[model samples]
Target: MKKTFSREGVDLAYRDVGDGLPVIFQHGLGGDEAQVADVFPDRPQTRRLTLECRGQGVSGYGPVERLSIATFAHDIEALADDLGLGAAVVGGISMGAALALRLAVHRPSRVRALVLARPAWVSEAAPANMKPYAVVGDLLMRHSPEKARRLFDDSTIAAELARLAPDNLSSLQGFFNRPDPVLFGRLLVAIAGDGPGVSEAEIRTIAVPTLVIGHGQDLVHRLADAQVLAGLIPPARLCTITAKSQYRAAYRREFRACLSEFLETLA
Candidate 1:
């Protein structure tokens, strides 16, 4: 069932389902709980909890000024505290992966295991890969939604992404079609420009078992970034899954298999 928890005056939404081996999984930018459900394996023995971050999904925007990865990480921390979970398997996709990594670094005691799926950032703020998102954000800020979509469709960025990263291109298109493009644009700009805030040295200090998933054909979440993360954490295991653009079915299957395999090892 869906639940709501207040954090810093914002009513954030969350889900606590199933009955054992609590796993705190999260969704990416412009994603909601349903997006997580699509890839998460269905198991009777595992309970999953996903908190919709501020300005995403059904969650309320709590102090819009505080939209960095650190803020989102703290929201997850607060969710864990509210649920009385001292430590659980923490993981996520894209921006969600960054949040999980941040928790593993700063709140190590609260992460039993780490699962980073399709990570987009490594150590620095505003990585080059995220430039497309910045472009979309700028368009939303500068022109009307219709005009922005028209402009983006005709831009070189769109042409390049259509040929190289169809999945990323599709996601960017969704931004133009959103009901609140302005708000989402601000969110995209803030988050795309923000990094995990945890340095490489700090990442090396993470002592828990970690699973980093990455694939090719994805410009936004590069496989190289995932490789770097896997190399940093001592117990991290790197897995390369099928790219979604190559085959959606295989991608989901491989994603679930990787997650299930890692979860079993933790058992």
Candidate 2:
């Protein structure tokens, strides 16, 4: 069932189901709770919780200006508090992964375990890989959605992404198709330029068990970023799965299996 909670003058939505090990698995940028359900293992013993970040899913965007990784992470922290959770497994995909990392580093007591899936950022701000998203955002801001889509398709960045990372290209192309391209454009610009804001030195200090999932064929969410995270966090287990672009079924299967194995270790 979907539940609502207020934070920072906005009514946010969350999903809490099942019963047992508490796991807060968040969705990626431009995704909702349904996205979390796609790759997360549906187990009777696991109570999965997903909080739709501000401006995404069914949640309200209190202030678009306040939209950042830090903001989203704090919202997640608030969700945990509202749920009366002292600690739980926290993880997410892409932008969601950055939020999870921030919680593990900044609020260690509330994150019993960490799961970084297809992480897009490691430490530095606005990695080069995220430039395509920024390009799309800029186009959306300058032109109408139809015109922006046409320009993005005709741009050199789209050409490069089409050849190298078709999946990433597809996601960027989807930006112009959103119901509120302008608002989503603002979000993309803000978050694409932002990182998890945690340095390698700080990441090395995390004592909780971590699972870092990575794959090939993804430019925005680089495998190298995941590798860097696995190397830094001391009890981190790295699992490489097939890229969703290569095979959707295999990608989700491997992702769920790796998460299950990691959760079993904690059990």
Candidate 3:
């Protein structure tokens, strides 16, 4: 069932379903609880909980400048504390996965295992990979959403970027009609400014089970990041699939199936 929990002065939305081991999954940068509805299929033995993160859907954005991965990690920490679900299996996609990784490292006692799906960060902040987000946010701020959208769709800059990294173009498209353009732009700037959120030594200290899922055709969540994570985390296993930006049913289905299989192992 869907419920609201008050945390850090915001009423965060989350859903707690199923029966056994608590599995808390986070949403990606441009996603909320509903966007991640495809994850965590009906499982009788797992209590799947999905958090909407601050400022995503119903959750409040609070301060525009406080939208870093670290802040999101704290929100999860607060949610876990409020729910009294100690050391639950924590996982997420892209920004969410990076948040999970940061939480696991900074708040080790709160995470039982790690499910890092398409992680966006690495040992340090990856500025090169985050540049597209910053640029898109700047564009939105300077021009109308319609104009910004057209530029990314028809301009030479976006065309060149599309050839080299179509995923970046796709990401910009998603942010075009953001529910709150001003808030979204602010978030994009802050997120792009923030780096990978964890260090080699920090990730190396994780003793819990970890699963790293990566894909090609993704400039935001590069496959190299996943490979490196799998190699770095002592108990991590790597799984690769087609990038979600391709919008292929086969790729999405494969991801869901892989994630389901991993959840079962936990049970």
Candidate 4:
């Protein structure tokens, strides 16, 4: 069922499933709770929660500038407090992963386990990774979605992105389908300008049972970023999966098996 919460006076929505150990997951930027929540596996012993962060889902958009990783982290903190989900397992993907990481860092006592899926942040910032997203932002800001899509589709750069990083290209295409282009454009610019949640040194302090997942051939959530996380976080396990834009049966099995196995270990 979809439930509501008052976040800084703005209404936020979320999916609440099952009943047991609260496992809350956050979606990536531009993704609503439903759109990017297919990653979670159903478990009978756990209550699965996926929240639609501000400006992205069924939730209301307050200040466009307040839609950020840190802001989202506080949203999670508030939700956990309201639900009385103390020391719950926290997980997310891409931008969501950054939020999860920040929550674990800032509110260490409340996180029982950490699941970092497709972490996009390597250090304080990932400027090189921001270039294409910024371009998309600029194009969307200047023209309509149709015109921007045409320019992106016909460009030499898009062809290269299709060949090497289809997932990244797909992410750009997703922006076109957003409800409010102006809000989305403003969010794109704000997200591109934001820094990583915390530095490598900060993540080093987290000693929770952690699962780190990365994918191949995806530049937006680079494999290297996941590897660095696995290397730095003590006793952290890493799982590699196929990018959703390039999913195959083998990758699906691997992804599910890895997560199930890790969650089983936690129990």
What are the lDDT scores of the predictions, listed in order? 0.91, 0.90, 0.80, 0.79
Worst window of 10 by summed lDDT in candidate 3: 34-43
How do the residues 1-267 of candidate 1 rate in per-residue lDDT, one tens digit apiece? 789999888899999998889899999988999989999987768989999998889898766589879998999988888788878999999999999999998888899999999999988999999999989988887889999999999999999999999999999998887766777778889999999998999999999999999999999999999999999999999999999999999999999999999998887
TM-score of 1: 0.97
Q: Cα RMSD (Å) between model 4 and the true structure?
A: 1.7
Residues 82-108, candidate 2: write the lDDT tens digits: 788878999999988999999998989
Global lDDT of model 3: 0.80
- The deviation in Å at residue 211 for candidate 4 is 0.6
- lDDT score, candidate 4, position 45: 89
Cα lDDT tens digits for candidate 4, 56-130: 778888887696767878887888788878788888887778878888888889889998888877566635766
Superposed model 3: Cα runs more than 4 Å off? 154-157, 164-168, 245-247
Listed in order, each prediction's TM-score against the native is 0.97, 0.97, 0.92, 0.93
Clashes of each: 0, 0, 2, 0
Q: Which lDDT tens digits does candidate 3 get at residues 1-267?
A: 578988667788887877788888888876877756675566677887788877777777887767888888887777778888888889988888888888888888888888999888876774577777777777787888888787767876577668867766766788898877777777877887886467899899999988888888877778998999999999999989876667667667877887888877877
Candidate 2 Cα deviation (angstroms), residue 223: 0.9
- The TM-score obtained by model 4 is 0.93
Give the candidates in order of lDDT, highest first.
1, 2, 3, 4
In model 4, the worst 10-residue window by lDDT is: 35-44
Better of 1 and 2 by lDDT: 1
